[model samples]
Target: RHDKLAVNYMAMVKLAMIQQHLRAISPSDRT
Candidate 1:
């Protein structure tokens, strides 16, 4: 369904955003 796809897409986007935020705040965590 289109609505379900949209919800999944939003969730993925939010997850990516949080990941980016964490990475930006802690660059030394990659090790």
Candidate 2:
């Protein structure tokens, strides 16, 4: 459904944002 696609997109965006935040918080320690 269209709603399901939208939810998936949002989840991906949130994940990307979290990753960026983590990178900014720690640039040396990567795992």
Candidate 3:
């Protein structure tokens, strides 16, 4: 159970990082 929770937490962190990266890049492209 503990391992599963850790894996889920890591996945969430990775997703957040990817989202932030995309948001950062998209604004520059718009202008």
Candidate 4:
């Protein structure tokens, strides 16, 4: 159970990073 939670946390962090990267490349292409 703890491992599952950790995996979810990491996934969210990665997703946030990707979003930030995309915004940096195109500030006007936000959804």
Best by lDDT: 1
Model 4 lDDT per residue over 1-31, tens place: 6999999999999999999999999989856
Tell how far residue 11 is off in model 3, in angstroms.
0.2
After superposition, candidate 3 runs with Cα above 4 Å error: 28-31
Tell me how many residue pairs clash in candidate 1: 0
| Full ranking by lDDT | 1, 4, 2, 3
Candidate 4: residue 25 lDDT (0-100)? 93
Task: Give the candidate number with the greatest TM-score.
Answer: 2
State the lDDT of candidate 3 residue by residue for 1-31, as single tens digits. Answer: 6999999999999999998999897877666
Clash-forming residue pairs, model 3: none
**Between 2 and 3, whose lDDT is larger?**
2
TM-score of each: 0.79, 0.81, 0.76, 0.77
Each prediction's RMSD to truth: 1.1, 2.0, 2.6, 2.2
Residue-level lDDT of model 2, residues 1-31, one tens digit each, is: 6999999999999999999999999998666
Q: Which stretches of candidate 2 lie above 4 Å from their native place?
A: none
Model 2 is weakest, by summed lDDT over 10 consecutive residues, at 22-31
lDDT of each: 0.97, 0.94, 0.91, 0.94
- State the weakest 10-residue window (summed lDDT) of model 4: 22-31
Task: For model 4, state the Cα shift of residue 7 in Å.
Answer: 0.4
